[model samples]
Target: MKKGNTLFFKTRPRVRSYAAICGSKEKEGVIGNYADITLSDDMYGESTYEKAECKMLSGAISLAVEKGGLTDCDIDAMLSGDLLNQIISASFAARDFEFPFLGLYSACSTMSESMLLSAALVDSGFACNCVAATGSHFASAERQYRYPLELGCTRPPQSQWTVTGAGACVISDAVGKIAITSATLGRVRDWGVTDVNNMGAAMAPAAADTIMRHFKDTGTKPEDYDMIITGDLGALGSRILKDLMWEKSYDISSNHVDCGEIIYKVIEDEFQGGSGAGCSAVVMNSYVFTKMNAGLYKKVLFAATGALLSTVSSGQGESIPCISHAVELESLAAGAQ
Candidate 1:
């Protein structure tokens, strides 16, 4: 991946439409205490995470396929993943569609990883077209990770709330032709922060390490890309990442941004920082896709970061481990026109 040298692969079909499907349950302004989360009688029933993920994928995929004027059979393959065990959300969602399926898991980085793989498959002549990725979130993640919201537990500022929603995207070899061109995967890194109260502190090193490697491997300067986005490193993590980069003299302060910070506007007081996997997924579909279509930015770097620690892992006194996957997206129409 030489920088400044244009590298080309067979272009995957353009992304025609992007959509987000979220649960109707209004959990806004419900914070600080764990007891505020209402699990029962919710739209997703007992399993809020998997159910909402499936619903969001169904809704987003239906809209994308419909808007793109594609039949179910027209989809060459479905590449999907989620945070659940065995990826039940993506697997169940794929069952409702007619396309061939590939289930993937990379913890929170699943969305970007799936998108990168889909783009590779399509560009490498392995598939004609593919629906890239989707993700879901539920209150259950909290119960499994920290404490059930129903327990009224107090959360530290470093903790990020898992969102209760889903997001999806459709990628193709044609239509608008905004396709992923390249990607970089980061090795897992542990900064030795174990409290989990502040994920930014734990995940910042991984984000910085990956971002630097991406530039090194690709030989692209930070200014070359219009925007450099990270997955779920909310306010705390974003700041930590910037500081770490500066310490290494990489200084990407102007272009660096985090999806976790963008998803929810009132992030400061409400969420302490921002959200989870759904954070990057929803922001990508709802915000970045629109901007790309509008021709606001030509080249963008999306780095989705994930912390690879379970409650058990943390409980066993293991350090919080983090990983990141990055993809480059560009508009073919803009370049052609």
Candidate 2:
């Protein structure tokens, strides 16, 4: 049911299983130990970085379905996206699966968008089992958004490294570790940030907008959630979001954690931190899921933010438009239904 700016699912769809797959550098990061698979080579022995990204996404989707003790035939639908133009990675990967596929595009917020659709489908009984995933490749994104790999261009201080990874989750009717209860769809917000190099600042306002709306719509305090996780905000954007929350008289400092800030180690030389479609996807499916299963987090707000500016739009001197989608996840023991 729609509640103000949020969608509340009475029959919360359970997250039966998930899988996280990444490259070598990501494997060396904080959530590495929790990932289902990590490739020694970022290329994954593929001919190109784009192909490699498709492979990681395919692997994640297959692993997630397998983890749930199901196969492609059992999956009713597959929804996924990537940072690439037309979401080529997701579309190309979907070719391997016989199930119905829906290619989505919400930049880095793709994970939340895909998950929201999956939860709605499962909760509505439109699908018995659904898989939603997203991914990004460093080489691929760099070439498309910034410069080519051959340029060896210097990155600005505010720039974040695009994580070479993928993550997938299986949403089913069966009660499981965690269930998605609500989703807050964000509105596009342009804060007049024109610097394409600093995605953090460009996307911060949207994250804050969604976060505040979610709290208001649900009549919940920031303290109500065990954790409030944001996607690809890095350090600067996270701070901006906190400031915005404070302006609204809510202190989210205690439980807020940014996926970008924690995905890589501090000394990894990743400037701000990780940013990409894969950052939140991999971290949530791995670290967050593992924590929920361990009973460490009873309630979590997963808000994935995205900068909706394309290369053409940026080149045309258009301010970056950003959005965020938040999903409320709670332990099944809470009796969400």
Best of the candidates, TM-score: 2
Candidate 2 lDDT, 299-323, residue by residue in tens: 9999999999899999999999999
Residue-level lDDT tens digits of model 1 in 1-337: 3243222345644677666654333224222111112223435543455575576666667766776678888888888877766778788888788899998777777778777777767777777667766665656466566676678666666667676555667777767646677777767899799877777778788878878887877777888888999988888788889999899888789998787765554675536455566667766766677777877778888888888887778889898998888888886656432
Give the C-alpha lDDT of model 2: 0.93
Backbone clashes, candidate 1: 15
Best by lDDT: 2
Off-target runs (Cα >4 Å) in candidate 2 are 333-337
What's the TM-score of each model vs. the native? 0.87, 0.97
> How far out, in Å, is residue 115 in model 2?
0.6
Query: Number of clashes in every candidate structure?
Result: 15, 0
lDDT of each: 0.70, 0.93
Give the Å error, residue 127, model 2: 0.9
CA shift at 336, candidate 1, in angstroms? 11
